[model samples]
Every structure is written in C-alpha cells, then in structure tokens.
Target chain A: MKTKLFAVPYIIWMALFVCIPIVLIVVYAFTNDAGAFTFENFKGMTSYASVFGRSFLLAAIATIICILIGYPLSIVMSKFPSNWQKIFTMLIMLPMWMNFLLRTYAWMSILEKTGLISQLLGLVGLPPLDIINTNTAVVIGMVYNFLPFMVLPIYSVVTKIDRSLIEAAQDLGATPGKVFKKVTLPLSLPGVLSGITMVFVPAVSTFVISQLLGGGKHMLLGDLIEMQFLGTAYNPHLGSAIALVMMIIVIICLRIMNRFGDGEGQAVIL
Target chain B: MKNMKKIIALLLAVCCVGAVMAGCGSGSSAGTNGEVTVCNWGEYIDEDVLDQFEEETGIKVNYTYFNSNETLYSTLNTGGASYDVIIPSDYMISRLIDEGMLEQLDFANIPNYALIDDQYKGLEYDPDELYSVPYMGGTVGIIYNTTMIEDEITGWSALFDPRYEGDILMFDNPRDALGIALLYLGYSLNTESEAELNEAYALLEQQKPLVQAYVMDQIFDKLESGEAAIGPYYAGDYLTMIENNPDLAFVVPEEGTNQFVDAMCIPKGSENKANAEAFINFMCETDVCLANMDMIGYTSANAEACEIYAQELDEEAAAIMFPSEEVINRCEVFKNLSPEALAMYDALWTKLKSGA
Candidate 1:
C-alpha cells in the first residue's frame, strides 16, 4: 500500500506530461483550425513523402554507423582493467555533458571549407574538406553526438555478462572466436537493441543537427513538422499529424528490432 | 527494506513537487508598478536600453525572444505566454491585425509616435496607423567578399552566376528566397499569381546547384571567414559583418529587393497596456533609438535618431545602412498573403528543399 502511494506522484506526472500531450497531439492530428474532425492534415502530408524517406534513411545510416563503431569499442572497453573501464566511460560521457547545440555548432566550424579540418588538410598538401552543409555532415553529427548512447549501454551489458559462461564455452574446446560468436554475442543482443533504439529515435527526429550541419538544404521530417508549427507554414494540425505518423512508424521499427532480442529490451524504451 | 524505499520515494516526490511550485511562484513575482512582458527578436535591442527603461519607469520588463516573425506569430497564436509588447515584421503585423491578435495603440500614451518618419507611417501593413509603431526597417541586399569575387556584382544575377558556383549561400526561408527570385524576374515580391511563383521556384531550382548552403545567421560566420563568397542578407547585418571583415561589401541590387520593417505592437489581452505604450514611447526616444541603432546596426525608424546615427557612420557604411530615397523607392514591402497563396508558397518551398 505504501509503495503504491509512493507511485502516485510518478503516475500523475506521466499522465500530465506524457499521456495528456499525446492525447492533445491525437486531437490536433484529426482536427483542422476550426477544431472539427478532418483528414486533410494527413492527406496533405503525402506531399512530404520524400522528407519522411530522407529522415528515416539518414537516421538508419547513422544508427548503422554507430553500431559499427560502438560495438567493437564497447567490446574492447569491456576487456580493459576496471579502472581503465571507468576512465573510458567517463571520456565517452564528457561530450554529452556539454550543450548538444554547442557541440553541433562546434562541428559546423570544424567541417567548413576554411575550418580546422580543411586547414589541417592544407598543411598535408591535400584538397580541402568540402563535406559541410551536406548529408555526410549530418550523419557525422549524429554519430558523434549519439555514439556514447550506443557505447555505454553495450559496455554496461558486456561487462555484466558472466565470465564463467565464456570460460565454460572455451573449456568445451570452442575457439575464442567461436566463444565470442556463440556466447558473448548472444548475451549482448539486449544492449545492442536498446542502443539502436536510443540512437535511431533521436536521429530520426533531430532538426538542429540537420539545420546546422545539413545547411537546411534538405527538409527532414523534424524540420517539416517544425515548419508547420513554428515556421512560416503555421499549421499545428499538420505538424501533429506528421508527428503522429512518425511516432507510429518509429514504434513499428522498434518493434521489429525488439523481436530479434526476444522482448528483454522492451523496458529500455520506457 | 520496502518501507524504507517507500519513505525515500515519498520524500523525493514531495521535494520535486515543492521545487516545481517554488519555481512557479518566483516567476510570477513582479515589481511595484507591475511587470510587462516584451517579446522581441534575439539581440534586437541594447541591454542598456532595457535597464534604462526599467530604471525610469518602475515597471519591470520581462524580456523574451523569438527568432522570426512566424515564430512570434505562433507563440501568440498558441496563447503560450501573454506578452505586453511584441516586435514583428510588416507582413506578420498585417496578419496579426487581420486575425485580431493585436490591440490598437492608444496614441495618447505613446506621444513619441510623432518621432517616427511620415514615410514609415500609414504603410500598407498598417495603413490606418492603429496597431503598430515602426521600430527598425531594412532592405534585403547582397553581401559579398570583394577578395573572393572579381566582378562587380550589380544585381541578383550574381547569385546565379556559375563563376561563383559552390561559393554562394542563399536564404533558407521560403518567403525571402522566393521574394528575391520574384524581384530578379521583375515580378511583385508579394505576387499571388501561381504562375509567377512557379517561375520564381524554377529560378531557385536552377540556382540550387550553385548554392553552397541555404542559411540564415550562419551567413555571418560563413561570409566573415570567407567560406562563402556572396549571399543575399539584410543591409543591417551587413554593417555588423563589415565591422568584422572589411573585405565584405553590401549592395542593394539594381533589380530591386524586399524591404522589411519590424514594429512594436501590443498583443490583444495585454494586462499592462499603459506600461507597454511607455516602453514603445521610450524606445522611440532619440537617445534610446541611437543607442539601439549603434549596438544592433539596424536603421532606426525614428527620423531624428536615424539622422543622428547616420552622422556617426562613414559615407559608405551610412549609405549601406540607410539607403537613399531613390534606392528606397526601388524596394518593395511584403504584405500578408491570402491563405491560398500562402499554401502555394509553402508547397513550392517544400518541393524546392526536397529536390523533388
């Protein structure tokens, strides 16, 4: 009874902030400016199909790159001494402590034609880096910002794995590679699943990274939705409709991903 | 153990709620004369002016910022926060007045309304001179690095010149981008015709390949650092940029350009109408306007203040900051568009950005 009483505040908080906002979004999604039910908002969204496709595609690419980089790094970190592991975790988290916008803005200076990378390349007698204001820069920003999210989860899970299980596999005449592939890899699936969820969801919805790094050349779903609400378009109904659709698609994608990890990672999203 | 956990959780919950309530309580505390909230553009005014206003009139000013006119509109439209005074551009002011979102100014309270130039008053956006007081006005023009581009850029054609390909930036927003294209094609910046808009869209599509990036504030850094050669931006910002990079120059293109005016107005349902008027009146004062113009680099709307401030600048900088009457005549102000026209602009802008 006391525990249930303690949960009352959390439940109220969730209902007010989370559940109420979602309800309002749903109401806005189905209504026009007159507050009457209409499907026009969703109908008009068909024109932004490319924006939807681009957002998902860029987010997927960023997620894949994060995993490619993070998984190996996490595995390596897990094998380090405990003190080194703590230091590595601290280093991974250091960037996250700074403002996200400031970090992305810093990348804008580092990637520009006359920026640090170009100056360094000039020193080496190489052609200047010309990737700023491109899709490549957007991907790099996402990976740099979200790499820790991917690494920390996998690192934590990999470190918590039973060492005896791997030893037992090796003692059964399984090669080190076979032990890693069969035992260690299977156990770390939950962390990898959660890590993908963490990176992909934010990457798909990010507007600032694309605006600052992608140079506002291409409209992502986030930018499109932002334009409808806060930009010149000024259509909250359309913004809510786009947001609802994006949420549904993200849920479906996460569901498919979670299926591979058999449901253990479901709690991570909540 | 379970009871101990519950006790701690209950304590934490109480603390959080108490903290949130305390925050809410503090934000509502106002001065003796009461507080007046003013929402203007970011870095639009000098901080000293705000302090002076507060000092002179014991009305504490709760200042906020919006980056664009559209953002200001949405904030007001959503009824998110009640603002006593708002600074929005000409077209946005028309839209707000049309929607009955603005309160008609009581000119008796704002005696300094006489200080605004006659030309700025009775404009198309506020023809009746009822709702808004012109704060600052500027014309859209090209800013270029002289060292990067060899040819003398006389007009909008330079924005599309293939010679400067991969070294140019363009406006990121739909209205400015399309308006520039319309001016280049000799059409009204506020044209409602679909054909003209489509033509402008085609021009922008053609120029997209040459544009290094579609930008707003980033134009400053890019232009200052010579990462970009030339781009269309406001003349006011050009003054600020030239201070940093002397190689940068600004020109009001021969093909004409969009002139914009940001004005001060009270939103409907303001609690402190008198205090808001006092603030606007204070802003129009010669010394205050000069201080703002000197700091922000925007052309003052106050006639006497503009004259005094222009004398401080050199011939070239002054000309760029406050273009001559003939150049002003060549520029056009944007008016609020019909709903259908606005939708068309939004669609065309989306298509342009999506590369579809």
Candidate 2:
C-alpha cells in the first residue's frame, strides 16, 4: 500500500504533463484551424517527405559516429579503477551541465569564418574550413552534445561485466581479439542499443542545433514542426501532425533496437 | 489496496485541477478597479518609463511581455485575461481588428495623438483611424560592410549579385525574406497571388546558392566581424552596428521596402478601457516617447520626438535612420493575408529551406 502511495505523485505528474499534452497533440493533429475533423494536417506534412528523410539521415549519421567513438572510449575508461572511472565519466558529463543552447552558441564563435578555429588554422598556415552553415556543423554539434549519452551507458555496461568471464575465455586459449569479438561486444549490446537510441532520438528532433549550426539551410523535421507552431506560418495543426509522425518514426526505431537487444544481445552480435 | 489507490488517484487529480486553477487565477488577480494590465513586446519600452507611468497615474500598471504578436494573440485568446493594452505590429493589428479582437480607441483621451507625424497615420492597416496608436516605426534595409564591398548598393539586386557570393547573409524569417525578393522583382510586399509569391520563391531559390547563411539576431555579430559582407536588416539596427563597427553602412533599397509600425491597442475584453487610453496618452507624451525613441533606437511616430531625436544624431545617420517623406511614400505596409495565402507562402518557404 505504501509503495503504491509513492507512485501516486509520479503517475499524477505523467498524467498531467505527458499523457494530457500528447492527447492534446493527437486531437490537434486531426483537426483543422476551426477544430473540425480533417486529414488536411497530415496531408500538409506529407509534402515535406524529403525534409523528414534528411532529418533521419543526419540523425543516423550522428548516432553512428557517436557509437563508433564512444564505444572505444568507454572500454578504455572501464579498464581504469572504478573510482577513476567515475571521475572520468564526471569530466565527460561536465559540459552537459551548461545550457545546451549556450554550448551551441559557443560552437558558433569557434566555427564562424573569422572565429577562433579559423584564426588558429590561419596561424598554422592552413585554409579556414567554412562548414559552420552546413550539415557537417550540425553533425559536429550533435556528436559533441550527445557523445556523453552514448559513452555513459556503454561504460556502465562495460564496467558491469564480470572479470571471471574474460578470464575463463582466456583460460580456454581464446585470443584477446577473439575474446572481445565473442564476449565484450555481445555483452555491451544492450547499452549500445540504448546509446544509439538516446543519441539518435534527440538529434532527429533537434531544431536548435540545425537552426544555429546548419545556418537555417537544413530544415529538419524538428525545425519544420517548430516553424508550423511558432514561425510566421503559425499552424499548430500541421505542427502536431508532424510531431506525431516523428514520434512514430522514433518508436519504430526503438522497437527495432529493442527486438535485437532483448534477445540477450545475441541477435546483434551474430 | 485498491481502495487506497483510488483515494490517492483522486487526491492527485484534485491537486492537478487545483494547480491549473491556480495558474488561471493568478493571471487575472490584478482585476482591481484602479489597476490596468498592459502587454507589450519584450524590451519594447524602457522599464523606467513603466515606473513613471505608474507613479503619475496612481493606477497600478501591471505590465506583461510577449516575444511575438502571435504569442500575444494566443495568450489573450486562451487566458481570456482582460488586457488593458497591447502592442502589436501593423499586420497583426489589422488581423486583430478584422477578428474584432481590439477595442475602438477613444482618441479623445489621447490628445497627444496629434503629436504623431501625419505621414505615419492613415496607413492601410488602420485607415479609419479607429483602432491603434502608432508607437514606433522602422523600415527594412540593407546593412553592408563598406571595406568588403566597395560598390554602391542601391537596390535589393545587390544581395543577389554573384560578386558577393558566399558573403551575403539573408533573413531567416519568411515574410522578411519573401518581402525582399518581391521588392527586388518589383512586386507588392503583401501580394496574395500564388503566382507572384511563386516568383518570389524562385528568386529566393536562385539567390540561395550565393547566400552565406540565413540569420536573424546573429547578423549583428556576423557583420561586426566581417564574417558576412551584407545582410538585409532593419534601419534601426544600422546605428547599433555602426557604433560597434564603423565600416558598416545602410541604405534603403531604391526599389522599395517594408515600412512597419508597431502600435498600442486595447484588447476587446479590457476592463478599464479608459485607463488603457490614459496609459496610451501617457506613452505618447513628448518626453516619454522621446526617451523610448532614444533608448530603443526606433523611429518615433511622435513628430516632436522625431525632431528632437534626429538632432541628437549626425546628419547622415539621421537621414538613414529617419528617411524623408519620399522614402516613406515608396514603402509598403504589410497586410495580414488570408489563410490560404499564408499557407501557400509557408509551403514555398518550407520548400526553399529544405533545398527541394
């Protein structure tokens, strides 16, 4: 009875904030400006199929880069004493303590044409890279911001692995490479799945990173939804419809990941 | 256990309802007879002026802020909290008047309205002169780095010129960007026609290849650092930019441009309409309006304030900031478009931004 009482506050919070807002979004998505039932909002979003595709493609690329970089760093960090690992992880997450918008703005100063990075390159007799207003900069922003999400989860899973399992594999005459391919990679699959999901979901829905770093050139699904609601267009119906579609895409992606991870990470390693 | 769960759920539901009711209650708590609620754009007025208005009137002024006119509309629509006064731009004011969301101002209370320039009055948005009082007005123009671009930038064509390729910045918003393109093509800024809007879209798409980026507030930093050579920006921003980087220069396009006016209005449900008018009258007082113009750097609608403020500026700066009547005559005020036209413009903007 006491445990049920503890859950009352959380349930109420979710019902008020999450469940009700989502219900409102669904209702808005199906209605026209006059609140009449219509498929017009969905049909309106259908025209931006390319925008959705590009958002997914960019997010997927950022997620893959995050996983590739984060997985190795996590393994190396996990080899340290557990106390040191905690300190290292804290250092990785320290940047996230600052506001995300502030960090993105910081990147703007570094990446602008006459900015610090440009000056540093000029001093080194190298050409300035004008990638601030491009998709590349957006990817850099996603990776820089979301790498901790990828690293922390995989690092936890890596550190949680029993040392005896690796020792037994080595005792069975397995090479370190073979042991890692057969054991560590498979054991870390759940974290890898969660990390990918974490990194990709926010990246796909990010309007700010693309708006600031992509220089308003790259219109992702998130920016499109934002524009519909807040931009000069001001159509909440279309924005809600786009949000519903993006939600479905993220759910599908998560489902596919869960199916692989739930099979004891076997479906992935094989 | 089940009965306990039900009781807890009921308690939570009651709490949620209480919170929502509390939120709505707080918005309307200032409904005292001697008080007035004023909502305006963020940083649109000097805080000291608000204090001054409260001090003199003894009618406690409860001031609120909104980032955009759309937000103002939605806040008023949803909250149904009676706002005594609001400051919205010309097009939004027109839309609000069409929707019967604004009150007919009792200009008799606002005798200082006569201090406004005759040129700024009787605009298309408020032709009958019944709804709004012009507060501050500005026109869109180009701000360029003189050191980077030696050529004369006489018109909007300079933005599309290939010579400034990868050096030109464009507006991140739809109406401003489309308005620039339409003016460059010698079309109306508020064209409701699909074909004319498509022509503007095509022009924007062609110019997209040359643009360094589409930016808003970031234009200040970009131009100051010479990261971008030219960008279409408001005339008021020119003074601020020149203060930072003397290399900056501004010009109203020879073709034409958007001249916008932000006006003070009383919403439909205002409780103290007379008090609201009193606030408007106070705002229009010569010294009060002059302080706003000097602080915010926008052109004051008050002719007396303009005359005084212009003298405070250098001759060239004054001319660029407050153009002659001929320039104002050439400028067009934007009108709120029908839903269909707005949707069409939005679609074209989406297509352009997506590079489709």
Q: Which number leads on DockQ? A: 1
Clashes by residue pair, model 1: none
Question: lDDT per prediction?
Answer: 0.92, 0.88
- CA error at residue B114 for candidate 2, angstroms: 3.5
Best by TM-score: 1
Worst 10 residues of 2 chain A by lDDT: A261-270
lDDT of 1 by residue, B220-278 (tens): 99999999999999998998998899999888999999999999999998999999999
Q: Candidate 2 versus the native: TM-score?
A: 0.89
- Candidate 1 segments exceeding 4 Å error: A265-270, B1-28
Instruction: Name the top lDDT candidate.
Output: 1
